[model samples]
Target: MRRTLGRMLADSRTQPAHAPGASNDPLILREARADDMPAVLDIYNAEVRTSTSTYQYAERTLDEQLALLSSKQTAGDPFVLAELADGSVGGYATYGPFRPREGWRFTVEHSVYLREDCRGKGIARPLMRHIMGHAKARGFHSMVGVVDASNAASIRMHQAMGFQVAGVMREGGYKFDRWLDCAFLQALL
Candidate 1:
């Protein structure tokens, strides 16, 4: 994870910062292209392996990520990548239906992940602001996130971003041979 962070930060520093107020930092949030898949996959797989940001244990193949992105593109959903001025992807954020039921159509669950070193640089705040703006513009009424209980930094970030702590599910998952608790945060768009 440290190695991944190091690489991301290094890449971030090499790129130029986006011009002020250029719509979520063009250097950060842009429609992801096909070539960005590899960098996205690396960041995603690293999170899966080292943190509870995702529940999956297996690393996703490039093909899988591409398919997912393709589906999002087809649906016109936001699949944004945070890139440095030199165009390396530093992180990503996106959302899908919170549930498959028709009644839940106005609600969605989203996730944002940044390479460790890319954190604390005001990257996530802008990324999330753009995501929420897109969701609201698209008529989504509610946005949700399920965060592992142990990830305080993420919880704080969510709170600071105007997401409330909706609830916590205790002992909801077993990972690494131990029970894990998960918290749900929600923001009304």
Candidate 2:
């Protein structure tokens, strides 16, 4: 599965056998597109506004989302989308360089965001699986996730997928009027 980024991008969408929660619409895993920015931003901006899922204090605008997408694309990172049959985005996943230094080239930091209504519905498993596969295919030696300590659900999900707690940065972030601890999880690819 050592596919080039172009080939991965050209791959067709998949209608997963997953039947998340009570919903009958089986999600499709596909490469994100420019037109999908609005839906993707809705899911991300919501987290920025309401949860510790993202540490950003302000919601992103459409232009900002597009710019982020462009940066990811330029860096050869994969941004995946989980979509229902009706075309609504349920979640998104992506990974980028762990750091700007060349020594960190073999490691990547990933992010996965699912809509609030879509959580605990088994949607995350497939999204993470795809992203992991994509990273491995690209020859990344390791994948990492820096999650908020309060986000037990996300940490658990990563652990279930072979990620181990690397360490914890005590009070690494401040948001919502308090300091939030950050848990670092790593998985060998």
Candidate 3:
């Protein structure tokens, strides 16, 4: 069974005031609202334009991002946003079906992103923990992260979170006029 956003938000409030990647500032990890789409889109589009985090070369519009968020909500998938003390939408994490086949129902692929300035501030760790908790609560048996092999920070972060490197696919993606290798990491819930 899927959990409601309200329930998830309420549950987050009951957790420790400061988890990893959190500091003196009040950090909130909760379901995203419609008004949050612009900030979310900005972060995503920045990645699309400048990073190999996503293979999408074209930037996504606000409507498209909003639609995707809506789809996640409709499917009861976890899509969480991280709010900094100043109320800025600094990052987000989400999970979706790893594959469409029925046998893959117990597995999900997850992703996390943070604003450029928000990195190294102890935000992603707690945000990712919230995502993992949600996935586990929703009965997922495994969570996978497909990260770029060259992205040391992300790789190390996943490793710190107990995700084991499952395998690597050389030249698995194309971006920036080159082929990029992808490393897959998995954590059993």
The candidate that wins on TM-score is: 3
Q: Name the runs in model 3 displaced over 4 angstroms.
A: 1-25
lDDT of 1 by residue, 66-129 (tens): 9999999998888898888777778889988999999999999998989888887777777787
Among all windows of 10 consecutive residues in model 1, the one with the lowest summed lDDT is 13-22
Q: Tell me each candidate's RMSD, in Å, in order.
A: 9.1, 10.7, 10.1
For model 1, the superposed segments whose C-alpha errors exceed 4 Å read 1-26
lDDT of 3 by residue, 1-189 (tens): 013323322333344422243335468889998899999999999999999998889999999998999999999987898998789999999999999999999999998999999988877888778878788889989989898877767866776676766777879999998999787878777
lDDT of 2 by residue, 152-173 (tens): 6786677667677677787899
What ranges in model 2 sit over 4 Å off?
A: 1-25
Task: Please list the C-alpha lDDT of all candidates, in the order they appear.
Answer: 0.78, 0.79, 0.81
Give the Cα RMSD of candidate 2: 10.7
Lowest lDDT 10-residue stretch of candidate 2:
12-21
Task: Report residue 131 deviation for candidate 1 (angstroms).
Answer: 1.0
Alpha carbon lDDT at 78, candidate 1: 88
Instruction: Give Cα distance to truth, residue 47, candidate 3, Å.
Output: 0.4
Candidate 2 similarity to native, TM-score: 0.85
